[model samples]
Target: MDIKNVFQAKDVPEAINLLDQYGEAAKVIAGGTDIIIALRENHVKVSVLVDISSIKELKEIKTSDDWVEMGAAVTFTEVMDYFKGHKEYSGLIEAASLVGSPQIRNAATIGGNICNASPAADFVPPLLALDAVLTVEGKEGKREVRLEDFLLDKGRVDLNKGELLTTIKFIRLRKGQTVTFSKLGLRKALAISRLSTAVYLEIDDDEKCAEVRVASGSIGKHGLRERVAEESLKGKNLDKAAIDEASKVLSNEVEKRLAGRSSCEFKKDAVEGIFLKAVEKAMVHNGDGSYCAMGTQYYPRAAGKE
Candidate 1:
């Protein structure tokens, strides 16, 4: 596909107008990360490039009221900077810092990451664990959907033809809650994740599991919640054995779904470690639990090794 025209939209309304005028052949480009790749590979048949990167409303990161809302254009770099002094959001902030190295993170938008719907998208798992909500604007008006549902499958989303992702909002975790993010990229940097996991567990003062959510990526066709695993830890005691069982359920769940995928076995093993680590971290931060008490040992391998 040849680049015939590039349309720059000043705001969400203008962007929607471009989409309406261009119809199916129009493609929206924000950071140009995915669209550029698509254009190079001839994967898209786009005539009008509706660039929304200049939209001011989509670039701000606002935290107030009941949720922390991010504009669709918020970059990974922005996310990391937004949470620098905040500890409760450390997990998601860390995930943002770890995604796609410095350049890619600087250019990649959080909305693009969600809309691209990659199974191994680094931030999807964390936002899922956060139980995020996305507000989308269309010709009719706006609609809000849970992040888990908005991101349905790989290379797919729930957006309508002219619906532009506007804002992403989620509850800001309270001061004693625990949240953690982990990923299993093949390398430390410049590598797509082979798998990733994020856990947010709110352990009460009595040391009982109050609220727990687990999400995984790259272990299936799309990142999804470990429902069975979440159910297993509900209202349970904070102990090594209980955490072990929940971790086992998560591993088994992913293995069941991505069974024949080439990376299933590797991801299964990786999930065990990631899940255990996330839970251990959460417990230590919020519960009266310790990694040493979890009866696990992690030996540092040689360089260029696991």
Candidate 2:
């Protein structure tokens, strides 16, 4: 890797100033799990690496009465720890746990996972399902954008020169609402996701699907919302039949999007099962018509436990 300077930023303003000064040659480095590899492989050319990993403001995870705000430099391990037993945020925890491996999770920031914009990033689909919003800062000012809109294409986001993603914010999950994630990989541990799905479900008092969001990974140019599948489930009782129909809808959509790709044939069929798993994981019910059970397991392997 060819590099000229390294700046250790103390705060968001300092990082923004360094990036503005260095322009396109400067790249933010948090965790360095992804950027370091990119630099080594010549995938990216950088003259400056602004280390924001130690910035206090960038490592915060704050929650309000109705929302949660996480700094861009917050690591996956931190995410998992903060939301560990919170059933409503189980999907977010599961996704964080499933990233690369324990070491990678400790060193991999959610912001980096997001900024890297990998098609198979474990944390993205769950965040998308939550309709998360991003707060970006630059020399000019700060601006917010929906996560769905911020993602443009494979390995791309709407981030501009001199701008740094500050925090990701989303509404807190409440009664009757839960998010769940499921994925397929070559092996249980240390394998990148081959396909994944996240479901944000809201079942009303009548046991009908009130609102549902389905997001997918490794099935498109980037993580995407499966609106057709969501539409099929809304207003319907979440019976096996309803879920199966939604799964079929997702299967069809995957076939359409991945039409000419070599993995299309397999993914189209496989997505149905994966989507169902995520939906089922979020469907735990209670007598008060609320989602009461956190249908996720804490994987010891992900926690670096033998």
Candidate 3:
């Protein structure tokens, strides 16, 4: 498990060249967050280490007409700094702020998070909820993959030999759109998650839900969207009864995948509580329930009040 070779690239072109030379025997290290973890566990063996942390092009944040494109090497700390004031990315900004600690956040990049492909990766649920896509470049050239398709299993992605994650793209949240992210890790600080959920919805003038996205992690080997629960909640009225029914759907979907886990019974109750709180918090601006005590006008799903 020794890292016998280490090569640092000054830019993306150099990085790509190094990867091309080493091919499958190579692995890119940006933040070194996941790579270090795997190396410590003796789970990953990369003969050629191409360090991409020095690459300038893969560390930018750009916004287009419909989306915000995040460079592969942009750290979680950088995301927090850049998106704190951005109107469209409140949910993502908050999620980034919650990753690891100050040191870990300073070193963990979004691409590394996605490419690491951990089922309980804290960032994946919110990104999937935003319907995010990925751009990957390899010797054959570049191609885009939907995040759902890119992550097929634990520690698995569609990235080919000599390929590098280039960017992540997602539409900017618009007016009337609200999103919530929740996670239950073993501890509050520096913990891997046990279960997590992301809820994003756009509400119409008639108080009905539109474009609802619900995804979860730690229920299986990969972070996946629950299509059954999402489809069931789409176009439904935003009311007490509908919210309760939607939570029921979510609980069952989670139950279907919770067998043999260390915390199925606890997850069964926590999942329902978390989803209901997410929906209720998202609807607070709609004038239905008491505001959460967090002193922020925004919905706080972890508080779990209706």
Candidate 4:
């Protein structure tokens, strides 16, 4: 990696101005967890590096009555700490905790993960399931973009030369709503996901599904919503049979999307278990006792228990 100049912007506006001045020659570095590797691998070349990790305004997390707003520079550790023991959003906390290891989590920013836009990024699916919106600031002005639309393709985003992602905001999970994540990786910890699922579900008093949002990573060109699977469960009672059917729907969707890829067969089968696990977790956290008895047999026991 060769860099002619390195500028540490003290604030968001200064960062935008620096980006505008350097144009495409400048690359933003927050935590440098992904950008450093890309630079060393020669995947990205730039004449200037603008470090925004020190910007205080970009590192805070705030919550309103309806939404939670996380600064672009907020670390995974910060996210984990904020949501610790909060069952409604446990899936997101789990995702953040599972990104890399302790050191990496301490340094990796949520904005960096989204901007990296890797198909296998662990955080993307959960955020997508939650319907996240991004606040991007540029020299011209500030604009908001949906997380799904901001991700254009593998390693590509909708951001322009002078823009900087400032914050990620999402609707807070409310009563009767639960979001959960399940990942199938090569190893238990610090492994890149082979297949993963995130589910957001809400059930009405009658036990019929009111809202369902399903998203997956490493099973498509980018992290995407599984509408077919979601449609299969919407307005239905999320029983074991319904979960099984939805899992199959997700598997078939994966098979169709990756028909000829070498990992298709494995992924097709793997997604069934992953999707079911995500749904089951979401149901368990639904807080209504609706699904408590549906799948209790499969729940993992405590460390000392049989």
Q: Candidate 4, residues 1-306: lDDT per residue as tens digits?
A: 889999999999899999999898999999899999999999999989999999999999988899999999999999999988778887789888888889999999999999999999999999999999999999789899999999999989999998999999999777667788999888877898888899988766555788889999998878999999999999887767788988888899889999999999999999999898888777553344335312222334311122
The per-model lDDT (C-alpha) reads 0.80, 0.88, 0.78, 0.87
Q: How far is candidate 2 from the true structure (C-alpha RMSD, Å)?
A: 6.2
Candidate 1's displacement at residue 76, Å, is 0.2
Tens digits of lDDT, candidate 3, 62-169: 988888898989999998888776544555776787788899999999999989998888788888988899999877788999898999789999988888998998
- lDDT tens string, model 2, 1-306? 999999999988999999999998999999999899999999999999999999999899999999999999999999999998888888999999988889999999999989999999889999999999999999999999999999999999999999999999999877778899999998989988999999998766555778899999999888999999999988987777778988998999999999899999999999999998898788654334333223221223212311
List candidate 4 segments past 4 Å from native. Answer: 285-306
Question: Which residue runs of candidate 2 sit more than 4 Å off their true CA positions?
Answer: 285-306
Model 3 misplaced stretches (Cα beyond 4 Å): 285-306
lDDT, candidate 1, equals 0.80
lDDT tens string, model 1, 216-286? 88776677888888999878876778888888888888788877888788877789998887776654322
Winning candidate number (lDDT): 2
In candidate 2 the C-alpha lDDT for residue 49 amounts to 95
Q: What is the lDDT of candidate 3?
A: 0.78
Clashes of each: 0, 0, 0, 0
Query: In model 1, which runs have C-alpha deviations exceeding 4 angstroms?
Result: 285-306
Global fold similarity of model 1 (TM-score)? 0.91
TM-score of 4: 0.93
